[model samples]
Target: MSKIDIRTVNVVQYVCPLREGGSLPAIVKADDGFLYVLKFRGAGQGKKALIAEFIGGEIARAIGLKVPELVFMNLDDSFSKTEPDEEIQDLLKFSVGLNLGLHFLSSAITYDPLVSNVDAMTASKVVILDSLISNIDRTAKNTNLLNWNNELWVIDNGASFYFHHNWKTWENHLTRTFPLIKDHVLLQKATSLEKASEDIKQTLTANKITEIVSNIPEDWLISEADSMSPTDMRNAYIEFINAKLSMIDLLVKEAEDAR
Candidate 1:
């Protein structure tokens, strides 16, 4: 297992906007050190984004993948000269000089997405895992998976809320379905679906799921977010994660019991 150490770095020169919602810089550290630049935002964005990153990353790490060390760091707003999109600029103006907490993922030194370091079987397993987790971030366009030195690493989990939308009333988003698991490579690696399923089930347990959502900073929740209390919102999210976890558990447990 890789260890992560968190520290502050002066990233003034490396700041750049990302193609996505935030901006960060590619930073270099002293020999044996690694770095990444994260955009700073006000407390208003709610901490849901960060929470998603935390949970996704934690789970990824548990499942035998390399996840970069993540930290919440304040940035000097003046460091990045490239003006943010007009809307982001206005939003920041109101907060005035507040440092946005940036999430730094150490660069994967030997990873390349365009090339496959793992077999196609492993890739299939990864896709199934992402699909079951409802991670909307890792589509073909983003392809956050990388192969470095014969190992695969997953990154950039900022878009993990596919199941958080209000589903109580059968909203349109309910159309989304968990991906088929039968042909997946990673899912098959399980001694039986039972082990993998139990792993996911434990992750989505009521308390664990609730903790993940509740831990989200108030700023990351959307403005005019659902009227539910944080606890209620958290409970709702628990149900969402449970839906998938339960399925995995059932699949794996029954298989294990049968054998």
Candidate 2:
């Protein structure tokens, strides 16, 4: 509805690493006195992952999905000295500057389809959001869905928008279909794709998408092989999202066929 206001805080402490993922995201405490799962800008996938996480979370929120509150975290170089693990200390040393964090949903358990039932609308929304972002992580293997306080919450969207990884040919994938939808954890539960698409069409306006894309830090858009300016990268993201949105009917069909 308006410019998305994201909070920025200084990371004060590195709690522990969620080492299961390659990014080595850690539970860090911020000056705001809150625990957040911090995604470092220096990690394997680097800032693009954070950008994807930022864009994906904002898009999920716009479509009325429950996503943990995302905030911009300023990581100081000094914090690296406190970390005893040399590997983690190196990550801290390199990730100095802006990073991304999701407000930790304490005690939340991973969603197991057999254990938790997701409603049709929410399931449909999740399917639609994942399709739009071309997210490749949410599968039977890693649902990436959390049950927080009895509500379905989406998390770890860093694997989305894979096209950005190869900016040279990224446009070729703008019209590509997400065949991987077949592996989606909620495919069978997304029974109302048409309705969900209709609803998202109303809320996820181009202006709103642009607003979210605009929040990506300028430095994150820079790459040695990529000469595109930050503005160009931002515009590319908006274009990719809208292009995918225009194909919602096709995506719905793909998801349906997958089942």
| Best-matching candidate per lDDT | 2
User: What is candidate 2's local distance difference test score?
Assistant: 0.92
- In angstroms, give how far residue 237 of model 1 lies from its true place: 1.9
How many angstroms is residue 107 displaced in model 2 relative to the true structure, after the best TM-score fit?
0.7
- RMSD, every candidate, angstroms: 6.6, 0.9
TM-score top scorer: 2
Q: Summarize candidate 2's per-residue lDDT along 192-222 as a digit string, tens digits.
A: 9999999999999988998899888888898
Give the alpha carbon lDDT tens digit for every residue of 1-259 in model 1. 2333334344334344444444332342222243453434442333454555656765565455566655544344553334556655543343333222334443444334444455543454355356555666564455666555457777656556544545355233333454433333233333534344444444445655555556554554544656666666556556655565556544444333432
| lDDT, candidate 2, at 3 | 73
Tell me each candidate's TM-score.
0.61, 0.98
